[model samples]
Target: MKLDLTDRQNQVLQCVIDAKQQKKRPYTKGVVSRMQEKGFQITERQCAYDLSVLARTKGTGIIGMRWGGGRTLWIYDEGCIQEGAA
Candidate 1:
């Protein structure tokens, strides 16, 4: 399922996907830090909001998230295609 995502949303998602592709540890934090380094001027809260929206629009089984303690984990369907990742 494809959802219409804003440019910034796409950018943030791309960051996540890219990290995953690189087999990087702590990909989630990498996404936030990389995006900030890219000068997106986004807060972690805003980025988390975007991910939540993406998870929703990504369809019921396409994405997932879990929050416990002070950390949140995001999941992506391995088979789902990300349109804007590098």
Candidate 2:
């Protein structure tokens, strides 16, 4: 299904993308926090929701967190990219 993201959601997604690409690392709480400091204003809950949307509709790989852990991480599935590019 096609996901119709709001401008804010797009901004959040771009933030995630930039963070991942810039450091060649997964999405983390620190990354999100830095993005928030840069003016994203998103909460951890919102980030989780956005991640869910990306996983379900956009097919971006899920940002995983260890069970009962503090850090968060993402894996960008190449399939998601190819699908989006198609």
Candidate 3:
């Protein structure tokens, strides 16, 4: 599905998708680290904010599940088409 998001948000979503595809659990820490490794200069707080916005936005297909102790599991819904991806 098509989505309206900033470049960083898009990168965050893509990171989640990559994590899922790689069979690794996509947690906020991992996601932020991955983004940083990709040279995005993202922090955990920024990642969380981007995720919250994406979850609230329509057709983005991002879901965040809190797993106690303030930890969150990020999921990229496979039901929607990933923007800029084939």
Reference-based lDDT, each prediction: 0.64, 0.61, 0.82
- Can you write out model 3's per-residue Cα lDDT over 19-82, one digit (the tens) per residue? 8889877888999999999998987999999988887886777777885677888887766445
Q: Which is the leading candidate under lDDT?
A: 3
TM-scores, all models, native as reference = 0.69, 0.63, 0.83
User: Over the stretch 20-53, how does candidate 2's per-residue lDDT look in tens digits?
Assistant: 6676555556546766777877777777777656
Descending-lDDT candidate ranking: 3, 1, 2
Q: Which 10-residue window of candidate 2 scores lowest in summed lDDT? A: 58-67
Clash count per candidate:
0, 0, 1
Model 2 alpha-carbon drift over 4 Å, by segment: 1-3, 59-71, 77-79, 84-86
Which TM-score value belongs to model 3? 0.83
